[model samples]
Target chain A: MDSMLSTPRAPRIAEQAAQWLEVLQRGGAEERKAFAVWLTESRRHVEEFLFMTAVDRVLEDVDPQQRIDVEHLLTQGAGKVVPLPAERAAAVSAGVDRVEPAGMRRRSVMALTALAAGCAAVAVAAWGLLAGTGWEDYSTVAGEQRTVELEDGSLVYINTLSQLQVRFSETGRDLRLLQGEAMFSVERDPLRPFRVDTGSAVIQAVGTRFNVQRRSRQTTVSVLEGAVRISTEAQTQEEGELVAGPQQSVPDSGMLQAGEEASIVVNGRITRRPIAEVARVEAWRERRLMFRADTLQDIAESFNRYNRSPRIRIEGEQIAARRFTGVFDANDPESLVAFLGAYADLAVDESGDELVVRMK
Target chain B: MQTESSKQTDGLAGTALEKYRKDLHRFLVRRLQHAEDAADLAQEVYLRLLRVENSEWVRKPQAYLYGVAAHVVFEYRMRTEKEPVTFDSEVMEQLAENPAGVQPDELGDRLGLERQLERLLGTLPPTHLAVLLLHKRDGLSYEEVARKLQLSVHTVQKYIFQAKARIRMEWQRQEAQ
Candidate 1:
């Protein structure tokens, strides 16, 4: 039981589940205390525990007939197919990546299927997501940044704590930004509409790139490169609903053009704005914050997005309102504090979980 | 305990349920394979949110919502615990439409994924599969499985981990596909 928790290659979620199951399987005071702490680490830890419990129950009851069928399929699949040299070369030489041993095995299988299934067996993004097959989910933990490349040649730059599911069907490419922010440099597909959905709003791309940040109240869709159609659920539900928006909301919904940005709020109101502050909006993904003629409060707000501790506070409206402009590492509060101390003749007090500033 | 740092973090992390109702439901729909179940799960999430005594330390509300949604999906699937359940139509259609054999029609792509899952499962050593099947299918606790099979709990757990790992890995591997 103890050894189960330390397995080297188990998926992190399953491994954490093993560790959690071990605690539940064995009852004790110290173990419970530690388990409580782990559970508090994130909502994820709790979900993993529940997931394991369900997976445990479900797999056991997999109908015996189905199990037999699967067993038969496994044996049959071993000698599944012999790929032609041409297909083999396409499988291995073509840019289809084999990053892991499992994928390597599947690539051979994919090669075999491509030859055998013809158009019928074309790999679809729906397969991966539906079955937990090959659909890759890219996410960042707190304060983390990651860049992921999708199978359809699309690139996703995931901002901190963001959850993005990259799903591509034969006819369409879809990215679901579950939370946080992600900038998608979508490769163009004419037949396959590339749609990025942020729950309330769908950013449809004809052939372009954009960013979607799902803040609590408003979802900001910013286009850095090309035009994107930002559609909200209500607008899509009743076209006139947005068309009746005194007139600006509907037409703009068709194309959120390059250098333009729009916010989709909870009430289904669409607010479009030119991305004049592109430098500032684009900086956090690069691990830095750029401010131009922004107030100390605004700078403080930007810094707050990146750090959980050492909060920055300006003393008064005069100090908070003073406009400052600079580029600083997103993770470093001390640098900003030092800069403030020197630039504004302020005193920087670094104590416990906060960095407070006031005029000298 | 409410400090300036906490306020700032709250702004970055707090997720009002209204903001992501559609997204949460959609996630459940994908996983649960039923819109009604997804809606029920979404409402459950909202109720859970309402019951939260302190929203502090509940950082990253969207991630948190999905976390809750994940549990809801698992729980929804598990509602039939110990009852014999066949592979989902999704799973069956996938099996029926596998590329090596027949013309899969519309279901081929999804059912075709069975090849990947089976291939991954087939790679596990027999011992690992046995332990996992016993634990999962027979509903035996690790200790019970170990005792029944005359093996150590450590051995039992190890194989279970291996099987679970393989399934999880294949699912993830497909993510990148």
Candidate 2:
């Protein structure tokens, strides 16, 4: 009787929401009127509709580059049985062979094998494998963050409004931090050194954890663990042209160890210093921003990356230059506005889309 | 008859504005995150409602009023934000409170949500997955997807609807755990 009964109430509501979603997408005055009636029938209808809409929003983030073998899937009976495409299978096999027989590679292989047993698991494994073979672009929109795990066991923590490109070859693992910030935890492969290119600077690491941020015409690299060899793009290019043998030393290049930071301008100027607060440099990974004596203008710029509405705008130079020291949630710009509003000399206007700050 | 319907529409808008103004303002404030902007937009919703041509056809003015409110908010964000708008913090908080909705930990992280989507999409039946990918990921219309898949447009719509409902139910089941 339970099996023969009608569908559960929750699923029935979900089905109704799905139908409404289709109707809403059509965008007619008549359909909208109907949707309004359906939506107001019960509070549960409204909640279910919002929930489904949220799920649809999440669907937009699915990688557009993902390629599915529709023909193969359809021929295989279109159920829980998904066969790996020919090219993806080749890629997986090629990866298994080229990867060194180290503990890390073995662990990665074991994980892949375990996932490969499930019908859908093969698709995920194939996606991960294919990402390693060629240049793939990974990016986060405004107010979003992403973590990408490369085939070589490295992990990239991409900050909001950032773009990164990754390419792995037999001899080297290369990454380009095109814009914004990224923290890389590189897996060790002495044969294929990890190198990140930021247009202005090229950071070469054998095995290290580092963060690179590209802002305007400047690129800042901070080492969290191990060491990295940093060189201007010009110097590396010149070294490649002149040096015939394995170049042991690169001219105008510097080595930075843990706790060291380097800033390279577009004009090949390099500045090195010890990081004042390593935790602050790493705070974005945890969705919190830590600022120490940072100007309001800079803080506003940072918060703007995570929020689109209620933008923070500094009205006066005095207010823009006011230094603040505190930790704030990256997603909550209102908290920052409230904090500034508490000050005696600062005025915060929350009446508009822009939270304007000025001298009282 | 036309004039009488227009007058009825005006009356409907007037009464609905008085009844739902505060509720509309609160709703806008939750989504727009600014009380002043919400207040301004609440007025705009009523103004737009008064402009509707088919006022007599609206049997439930309250539903239509809230519907117009949502449309106004959507248009305002699309004009100003210039980026894809996700669930507002209020909606997200409400969803987090519901047991059948996505967990807070999964909702807060974009990467986590993405990976969960990838895994969830993998488990879908092949035809459902193909239809979903073609429609959502590729941005193909139902007719275009039908032509490409050699299925009727109605079948395509049914597949998409079924896929979405399946994913939503599965997501709820996962979150309930």
Candidate number with greatest DockQ: 2
Give lDDT tens digits, candidate 1, residues A143-251.
Answer: 6888775655466889887888775655456667778898887654433557776667777764345788997788998886556666665232231111212113444
Compared to the true structure, candidate 2 yields what TM-score? Answer: 0.42
Model 1 residue B115 CA deviation in Å: 47
User: Tens-digit lDDT track for model 2 on A120-208?
Assistant: 33334434554445568999998899977676657789999999988775445778887999999776554455788887878876446
- Please report the candidate that would top TM-score against the real structure: 2
Query: How much is A338 displaced in model 2, in angstroms?
Result: 1.5
Q: Which candidate comes out best when scored by lDDT?
A: 2
What DockQ, between 0 and 1, does each candidate earn? 0.06, 0.11
> Candidate 1 regions off by >4 Å?
A1-137, A234-252, A277-281, A314-322, A343-345, B1-177
Native contact fraction per model: 0.10, 0.21
In lDDT terms, how accurate is model 1?
0.54
lDDT (tens digit, per residue) of candidate 1 on B28-108: 213322323333554565555445555431433333444455445444555647544443535323322331221111223
